[model samples]
Target: MELPEEHSLGAHRRVSEARHTISEILTRSQNEHFAKGNDLDFSYVSSEGGRFRVNVYRKDTGIGATFRSIPSEVPTLEKLALPPIVTKLCDFHQGMVLVTGSTGTGKSTTLAAMIDHLNQTRRLNIISLEDPIEFVHASKNSQVIQRELGTHIPSFAEGVRAAMREDPDVILVGELRDADTISMAMTAAETGHLVLGTLHTTSAVKTIDRVIDALPVEQREQTKSFLAQSLLAVVTQVLVRTPEGHGRRAICELLMMTKAIAKLIQTEQTHQIPSQLQMGRDLGMQLLDQALLAAITARTVDPDDAYTYALEKRAFQKYVTDTTMLSKLDSLAPAAPVPPTNSTD
Candidate 1:
């Protein structure tokens, strides 16, 4: 079958290679079936040092396929270029650590990195429930039981409940998408299991709000209280093109729950949480713009890219400007004169 050529040469070559690999998988196994024919859905490691999640389907007279590339080797914290504050989440023994970002911002990669760290260094039973099983973990000091959503069980919520019975030390849920899944994850954390999950949100405050809003109005208050007690930290990230013009890097905003922050969440005063995060830098908390400014100053990301991802662009702009500009502005402003109203009074 003739496949449509991709626009870029790089993309075309990758697609061609993926197609060849898919064809091989379809023909090699007799037990595999797809679309009531010889087609099959399978995953394999690509020759280019990445993993592929493939779907083979029958089209107008031939077989067509789509492949999603997953990284072959799990990236380290340094390699992923995430903030140092993320490592702090690993210190928590049990609680919900949410890695939140918009789609395609490397949330899955970050989760995999954390799991890989625990798998290699710590002796624990790790249970992972993924939609399509993106990363394949090799058991080291820890044993990993990876359960694909459809292959192992029916849904994420069910898989999570089942994980509790499996006697796991760490549980990784692909996404906390619905209230059922979120509630299950919180329960797992509350029961002394370390729960790690991802969410589709851009800021820590919004992530907290999203979880609360996901529940019914009557349950919202109770849900917030549970979250305040079970939530450990919220890491929000965005990927930006590097200033070096080669690849992308992540800009992360970290929000670690303190007593004050927990009180704010319980009271439904989430807007104040961001300011608390900004003020609590000593506790590994940071606002999104602060991360962007740091990335810009380090030359790891382009100024324009940083500005684009910044939550408060004007504040970030002022932060990135030279001291001379601040000095000039200060000099141009008039000083206040002493008032005679007090003496007259």
Candidate 2:
């Protein structure tokens, strides 16, 4: 596939050279990561002294890999543009804190920031299980151990089980993609280990529902109870282009698991979460649409961008102030066709 203009390295050298380079990297990664099988789902590759998480696969054109550049220096929460509320999550002793969003929404970056905060402030064992291990954290006040999925272990479920034996004070499961992993993560939290995980869900309420619904029907009730007892907070973010068009900003929805929230999750009344979040302004909780409105009001994000990520498009329409964006919004609404122009035609 052709690379995007921004991430592209320009038309440097020949196409064959680029393909050859990518092929060689894949060969080395496969040999190092998968010695017994030919699967290449996820792997890490180092190029030009920088590490990248690569997803290698076959395309109709040829073998292709998508590269995500990992920053060498870990950024703090404030530097990453995360709300100040997220910093408190690092201070939680034991419970599951989830960073959730769609792909390319900076979930990994936010998790890295949280881990970095813990590394600087706490003297404890921190274990991380990632598919390719995006960020590398050095031991500071904390003892940090990062294990890759295929390199250090086989899967996240197995890794979480192993982390329990490692006597970890905190465990970061790269993602909670399945029932087994989610269950193990909750157990880890229940057993007094702070667990951080990521999910691909878009909103707080959906995230809670996703976790419960990921389990078997019989296991769901028990898992909901586990989640109700162990979940600390759910932070959902979406990246929006800045008004200046130079960089992107994170519009966040933060749900801190309060007493009422715990009851809601336990009783499986997740649909009422938005109303609770609206009333939780003093607790630093905000819905995704609220966050977007704040960004729009601050003039940092385009109104149309806010509308794109808003949960309720009709409700968010009132916030569009840009004339061009308003025109676009108007165009999207169904138009009433002129009644048959009888004799005028």
Candidate 3:
């Protein structure tokens, strides 16, 4: 059979093919007694070699599907073009490491990479509770158990509570979406398990606020204390198309918890967390603008894109232009030869 032309495969064609494929997959899985649910989903690469994380839902007519590409292979920290500091978070044995960003910013991929690294290098048991389990990790040196939300358990909170009994060293909660899940995750972290999770927030401070605010007003104070004590780091990332226009790269804002940050969180003065991050480079903390500025100076990302996401736009503009800051940035950039001037007209 001839495949539809790329351009001719419009939304309708794509949707129709998706619906048909999903229905077929569901029918086959059901016939095999796969115990698929009403909201059955799976992640796989297509025949064309495009990786996809898909959701199949039962509609009135039939099954409908929505798919997101799961890059063929997991990306290394360098392959993703993330900053070096990102790896530092993985060094911690116990605490919470959060990857926060807007939807479609590759948060799941980043978390998977970290978990994969641990699975390969650390001889520990890792338990992941995902709604649909996006990435499938094979057991390397570590034992990996991936439990799906609806199929394996009723919810994230239940999965987390049950993971405690499994004696997992590392727990990956797909998302900290609600109060119950967040509270359980905190408990896991405080009890000496390394908890990794994602949040839909733009900045480091906002990520902190989102967690604390997820709890009730009366519980806010105690929640802050719990977070301040167990929080290890928050990595907020954004995908920007490269200036050369090849593809995309991530610019991350990493907030490493420090004494100052902990104090601020404990005192309920999270508004000051950004400034603390701005000044706490000694602790490996950085603001989003700092990462953007570095990307801009290296010419890895466009200046406008960097400026747009910068938390301190004016400071970022000045840092990109200020001779002192430029000198520092230039030192960080890759070494390149000076261009030769033309002698002949």
Candidate 4:
């Protein structure tokens, strides 16, 4: 039997009630009625001043809701324990820096941290477009203006276009969910404003492909050209159980755009992108597999969990102590990459 208890991002309490009772609580807390066949995304503040990101959606069993506890203060890159190199991505005056991960993986927190860093260090105009604003930023060094979708604008595309005309030096898009928004972000980057955005992808290569694939066949080639010029880096994150099993930690794959990598993108040789990441340690790029391998080597993360998410499964095969589990993982792993052609064209 499914329990009435639901987990919030940071909260661990179990609330026992009927499903309808839970829905009523949500409606009362947010004061928004989500009609049938429609969903609502918004933030709620507790009587204690705690904030949570809430989502209510239609489900087969009736209305389903999920809540993610938002930290009152945004953490810094150092606080998140992300690499020092991550700070360099934020330092770029103009270009696109993409933070990508699956849902519930803290992509929002990473972007918030970057914005927080800018808030503490830089003097510029920072504009954010969120579905429903989560963390609130008060201007310290950089000026911040946060906008919500339903409350402030109709869509992220409109907000982005409007941001361009508003004299923003940095624009934060909560998600590059569609082609138009992604295209607008690239355009903004090309026009000399640093654009920080998120994508729902697993690796750096897939992140690049997602942008190109989202476009029409007629627009893809040109979009690649724009992306090749405007993309500064792609940081893909995966959360894994920490060594103590009491919390989670981010395993990251950072793809820093370089001349050779950019050429590979232009030539559409994206399969070779992983090879570039392997050779890019001095340049601050790393594959998800590499990060997983390190985490495994340090005994900071379980080998079994790392293998489950690894793109190149062979890297962690020897590290996994459970033969039965290794076999189980192999069954679910995708087919390996095709060998590169040696013939000169």
Candidate 5:
């Protein structure tokens, strides 16, 4: 059900097809509550042998829906071009790790790979609560229980609360959408589970602020303290078109929650996170601009692609004027830092 983003279909045909698809998905969802709103979100397997997370809503023109394809076979981290350091995340017994980005930037894909890595290597119980389960995993060394919202569960907050009683070693909340859900996910981390979640923000600093802002003013400080203690890493990613124009390359900005970062979160000084990211290179943290520059120098991504998604345009422009500076930037030493350690779960 992967329709072209831009299509020449007539207005009437588009509306008709959209309604039909919505009806089909509703039939599969078997939830009587779908008629309560102007929009509905669900997942359905098409007759054409594709699994998709479907969203149907009322647009100005008429009814419209989007179908995001979910691959039947889960891909590996190396296949997705993720950094090797990502493998280290699986070793953490308990903490919160966030995979963040704008929509369609491969955030879910990255998380799926991480979960799959755990499935292959660890003998732990992994439970994922997704709005509509995508990239279904066949448990390997680990036991995975994936719950779909509206189908298998009521809400993410409820799902996480249920997971606590399920004796889960790892809990993956698809996205921290609201105050209640965020609170529950944080509590899950605080108690004794490794919680992996996603947010819509484009950078690690904003991700921290967004989580705090979602809560009430009175609860923000308490939430920050919880986050400072339980939070582990935040990976912000964006997909840029490859230089060959055949596929997309992911430019990742990784932020490992170190003692300094934890202190910043505890004090609600999130603005300093960008500075920490800049100097925390030895620990594998990098800014989006740095990742973009490295990709450009390596010819994995085009200059235009880098400029289009860069947070600072001037940063990339410097490489354009001075050709020899690329070597200096590439040869920069990584700062020495201790491996990440978290307090009691």
Candidate 6:
């Protein structure tokens, strides 16, 4: 598939290499391939020293692979155009901070940047658990120990469980993929370690909901209580093309754990949290629509594209040239969401 120029992930062209050559690349990238249908994700160091996270697998037709380049240097918050609120989220000594988004939405990159910031400025020891680790960090002000899934550790839950015993001041759970991992990470947070993690959720409310929902039905309230206490913030983002169509930038929403917000979470009143965010602007809270509106104002994103990610669709209607979207938002009894298109980014 030919990726659009505005694609934030990678690869504009389809693979044209010979099957044997592609197979060779896959084999050399990872010593041994997984079963035909299973994706083997591993990082590859090119002969020239560039890095890429590759997924090699087989499909109905034949072998298939996808490569996402990894920069040798991890970007700083300033470089990513992230608000200072994100850096502040990293400053907390203890609590859980989640950087969330769907696949290819730059959650991993954002996490790496936050970790890079901690690595450069803090004196604490940081431990990271990743699958096919992307960016590599060298110890600077802080000591960083990165463990790969199936390499140094068995699973994220086990890795996080083990990190607690390792005297770590900070833990990075690459993916909060299961219930045990989420619960353990929260436990670590409650015990005075700053735990950072990622989820496939697209909003702060949904992110909180997902955590509680992932637990057993009987454990939801307890998990909610723990999350209300331990969660520091949730920064959710999406990368979209600029109106000029030259490049892409991340639009993010941040929710700092204020007392009111905490109370709402503790009581499972999550749907009303967005109102708290809007009122807590002076306290550094942000909403996805607010971010999207800002991006539209700054000419950083196309109006139609921004509309797809906007929670308050009416807010974006003025900017969008297409009146049909506005009609969709207004014409329904209760407006339906304007869903986003599929993007590797």
Q: Candidate 4 has which clashing residue pairs, if any?
A: none
lDDT of 1 by residue, 1-345 (tens): 335455788867866685675656554332344424755555656656677876666555334667777777888887887777787677678889999999889898899899988887789999999866888899999999999876787889999999999999999999999989998998999989999999999999999999999988998878888888999999998998887779889888899888999999998899999899889889888998887887888888877666667755556555443455446545766798977665553
TM-score of 3: 0.78
- Model 5 bad stretches (over 4 Å): 1-18, 28-37, 318-345
lDDT of 5 by residue, 138-253 (tens): 99999999999877889999999998999999999999999999999999999889999999999999899999899999998898898788888899999998878898988899
lDDT (10s digit) by residue, model 4, range 34-80: 64456778887877898998777765544467778998989888878
| Residue 83 in model 1: lDDT | 71
* True lDDT of residue 130, candidate 2: 91
Judged by TM-score relative to the true structure, which candidate is superior, 4 or 5?
Answer: 4
Residue pairs in clash, model 5: 282-335
Give the runs in model 4 whose Cα sits over 4 Å from its true position. Answer: 1-33, 329-345
TM-score of each: 0.78, 0.86, 0.78, 0.86, 0.85, 0.86
Stretches of candidate 2 exceeding 4 Å from the true structure: 1-19, 27-47, 318-345
Query: What lDDT tens digits, residue by residue, belong to model 6 across residues 1-345?
Result: 122232333322323243444556565425344533466788878889989998766665445667788989998989999888888887899999999998889998999999999998889899999987999999999999999998789899999989999899999999999999998998999999999999999999999999989999999888988877888899999998789878678999889888898899888799999999888789788898998898889887888889988876776777998888877777665656999989995
Per-model C-alpha RMSD: 8.2, 5.5, 11.1, 7.1, 11.1, 9.1
State in Å the error of residue 33, model 5: 5.5
- Taken over the whole model, the C-alpha lDDT of each candidate is 0.82, 0.84, 0.80, 0.85, 0.84, 0.85
Structural RMSD, model 4: 7.1
Score candidate 5 by lDDT: 0.84
Give candidate 5's error at residue 301 in angstroms. Answer: 1.4
Better of 1 and 5 by TM-score: 5
The worst-scoring run of ten residues by lDDT in candidate 6 lies at: 1-10
Q: lDDT for model 3, on a 0 to 1 scale?
A: 0.80
